[model samples]
Target: MKHYFIAHKLFLLFLAKFFLTYILLTVVYQLYLGGFQQNQIDGITQLVSQNTQQLMRVLDMDVLVLKDKGASVMVFYKQKYIARIIEGCNAISIIILFVSFIVAFSGKIKPTLLFICMGSLVIYGLNVVRIALLVVLLDAYPEQTAVWHGTIFPLFIYGVVFLLWVLWVTKILDYAKKTV
Candidate 1:
């Protein structure tokens, strides 16, 4: 029992450091990405609108906007979810927070009040590409639109966000530390 307690204490410390590092990374990354994403989103909106008009001449549907706020694509397609993508970045933050608290309560970390803010700019980029491809596919293969919407596009877009999260945790954040 004594040995178990000691081991748990040590493990808790490592978890704490991991969590602290994660919080710092998330905050800085969020601020950095928020601005960059806005600009990219604006550009994507323009591109999608121009292209959608040229390609899909549907009687009722229209590409009203193209922008990713955090991790969502709000496409007012004839007042429906014509084209949209939800991001997990916000959810990631919550997940991290919960993990951090769990480890902390185990007598490990002191969760930062600065708050963990997962960055989703890369996810935003993926969404732009996702929407663009969906638009193209809708035009070229109208018959297959439903399939693309339900399966292919979600996989592609969410896959990108998942990949970005993996990279951020393993690569970008690590490289950032090495450089520092």
Candidate 2:
């Protein structure tokens, strides 16, 4: 048992750090969300919806995002109701997961923090674009809504995160080799 533990110490450390960071951040996010009334949307989700509206508009799409009486925004394009932007659409949960992985294999404090911030921004921007694209595409192909929303978009977002993780790991590995 001792030999097994010794041989896999780094992997164990990574798992510990990843889980701890993930849990801590998730708890904090839940607490922040808990402060909002059940009928109201949290600030992050609201901002994400608004940003999607703006991006779609910039692309010359006739888009509108209106706050519902409940905890979501109604998205309309071409004057037709297309979708709803909810808390899950905001991508904070995905950002939390991404941050946890980076912190788990963390390098120096400055680079780690910088990478976290940059990676988060990338995730946020991409999420907004994802939402916008989904809205537009769903409006066009209502019959294929399930495929677009359930499979394609989720795969796209997760794929980007996986790519970012690979980049971070490779960069740190190179740094480690140079310092040796």
How would you encode candidate 2's per-residue C-alpha lDDT over 1-180 as one tens digit per residue?
A: 999999999899999999999999999999999999998999999999989989998899999999998999999999999999999999999999999999999988998999999999999999999999999899889999999999999999999999999888877435456557
The residue pairs found clashing in candidate 1 are none
Best by TM-score: 2
Give the per-residue lDDT digits (tens) of candidate 1, residues 1-180. 988878798566767766785787578647655765432533334544444443444434455554555444555544444555343322345344433543332321232222222334444444545565676576667789779988997677656555644554446445345547
For candidate 2, list the clashing residue pairs, or say none. none
Backbone collisions counted per model: 0, 0
Q: Weakest 10 consecutive residues, lDDT, candidate 1?
A: 107-116
Question: How well does each candidate superpose onto the true structure, as a TM-score?
Answer: 0.37, 0.95
- The model with the greatest lDDT is 2
Looking at model 1, residue 135 earns an lDDT score of 60
How far off is residue 43 in model 2, in Å?
0.1
- Kindly provide the TM-score of model 1 when superposed on the true structure, using C-alpha atoms: 0.37
